[model samples]
Target chain A: MTPLAAPKALDSFFLEARCKILDLAAILDRINRGQGAGAVDNDPRLDKIRKALEVLHDQSGGRAERIQQIFSLDYDPGWDKPKPRY
Target chain B: MYYIDPHIHMISRVTDDYHRMAYAGCVAITEPAFWAGFDRGSVDGFRDYFRHLTEVEPKRAAQFNIRHYSWLCINAKEAENVELSRGVIQMIPEFLNKPNVLGIGEIGLNKNTKNEATVFQEHVDLAMKYHELILIHTPHLEDKYKGTRMIIDMLKQDRRLKPERVLIDHVEEHTVRHALDNGFWCAMTLYPTTKCTPQRAVDIIEMVGTDCIMANSAGDWGKSDPLAVPEMIQEMKRRGHADSVIRKVVYDNPLAFFRQCARWQEWPAETEVEKAKRKPAKAHA
Candidate 1:
């Protein structure tokens, strides 16, 4: 069984989110390149975004499942159930 | 959607981030003194950092129309050097009266070490002596629960320190109750990884109502987002929370907390609010 297959709705949502992240990266790249020759190679803000993109780019094999597991919230349906007599 | 980031490390953030935060309705922010990604050599280093927090950063934030406030302290990570910590603590009072200065904070246990606890109590003593508000930074992951308890125990031991005046930040499911039950304010930090995510923060807020609770980005040199509070607002919206409820968690609550600071002044004056309301609408040509 493939645990990576999300429901159709969530898959669509993740796709749109991925596109927006890439769009942001492109805009940042454009701004960085627009600086021409004098731009300092090390900017904290750009560095952070690059690190975040690297995390995104590294989502291959079982890494995607692991990411989902790390972030998943647990909801107990029977949280309010009456306790059994001991 | 105007909100205040109750705790952020803007010293590590860029000016462009400030512009974006201001545009996104951040009218104010409070930066707590935390580790600068490394250990410094002397008390003079902390003095300079405090000056930047109270002087330079305020001016930079003001350029974007954001009111910047700061808390002064030798963070727990640096508190390991008890000698340097004591020196920095002795010098903090010089900046206590700075208009932008809030109080002594981002002070708490890093590894729950004995030296860290001694320095933590000393900083608390300084805060009590000066009547300054306190902001706490609890340990991360495995240490969080135990460290939060130790910090709380230390705080409880000080009879003069009022619980309400202290904010224990970076609270999670296992620790939020301890802060609130003890009557201290709590903050959930929204980070991309390692700490509470926006959804988890919202869940915690749902489990525990908005009283004495708030959220922050904790945006710093590490991986974080300055716009994380807005992302939490979005999460609240998706979960059917009201605008007023969201505003309470993001805006009103932080304002309420900051008002306790000896130096905090009211922002967005009534006259300014009235002026904005009274302005006539422009017609298209």
Candidate 2:
């Protein structure tokens, strides 16, 4: 089966994507306006979000998976080992 | 546009949710046993939950012309209490004979802890002993990749469990290929937030094709939507996918998966005219 034609796919979703980008921008603006904003300037999660935004601009495809990985946990080799209960 | 939510938690949803889902063309659904927000104190708590899954929920769904089937297990959250989990696993066989019972599932890891793994293997033993199918719950955001890998390794370690007889739920963009590459059936949980959205699910379908895969709402005692599968159908249509391609993913793939169970019964039988109406599309990807 042929993949969704890139031009048609973009045309179908442009408005929805525009709305989501607006939502993300509004969310970040709200976060910056909050009282605790300065304290979170160096937060790693925010850094990751920034990195994910950078990924969105890349011309190479697969941005969805790359962005998902940006927010996902790094694989821990010893995750199955016994650990202290919190 | 008829679809099946291969994984959903109707026990946590209201009757109106079922009404809405039925109107959205949900013909059937399978509710996997999952955490009840908090850990229960004992095995009897789980027994009552199972009774609800196997008994009450099916009747509730039937009111809306929806066929409800369920998987049985002590979910990972409660499985941390190994002693209680064992008792629950031992008692699961009591409901195995119930007409709606499908297999053992939503049964894998949460934090990828050793105790969770221990109980998961025990559930596998119970499932294997009964010749039942298995369904797994991979962990959430931070732990998901590792947790899914751990669950796959554990299942692979047990030679008696065939990959086809098991399904790994909650697969995302990064982990979906791994689950499918290993030969196990997989599902994407479409949520309004946190998990895959309708658009992302459609993207995954485009990337992976439609074989041996399915999607679900996983609607439960949280922020979720019971009509997520239909939302995916709409997204597929908007992307210009053929109806046959959309139907195969939402309807045919789930039916093919569930039909593997020993007690599996045909549901909502389609008439010859209905079959003729849905022209077969090319079945690639």
Which candidate has the top score in DockQ? 2
Error of 2 at B26 (Å): 1.6
Residues forming the 10-long window of minimal summed lDDT in candidate 2 chain B: B274-283
The alpha-carbon interface RMSD of model 2 comes to 6.6
Q: What is the lDDT of residue B275 in candidate 1?
A: 54
Residues B146-237, model 1: lDDT tens digits: 68887887787677878999999999877888899999999999987579889778868877898999999999999899999999989887
For all the predictions, what are the DockQ values? Answer: 0.03, 0.36
Q: Tens-digit lDDT track for model 1 on A3-83?
A: 122574366368767887788878877786785524645765555555555557674633322333333333232222221
Query: Model 1 misses residue B157 by how many Å?
Result: 1.6
Interface RMSD per candidate = 16.7, 6.6
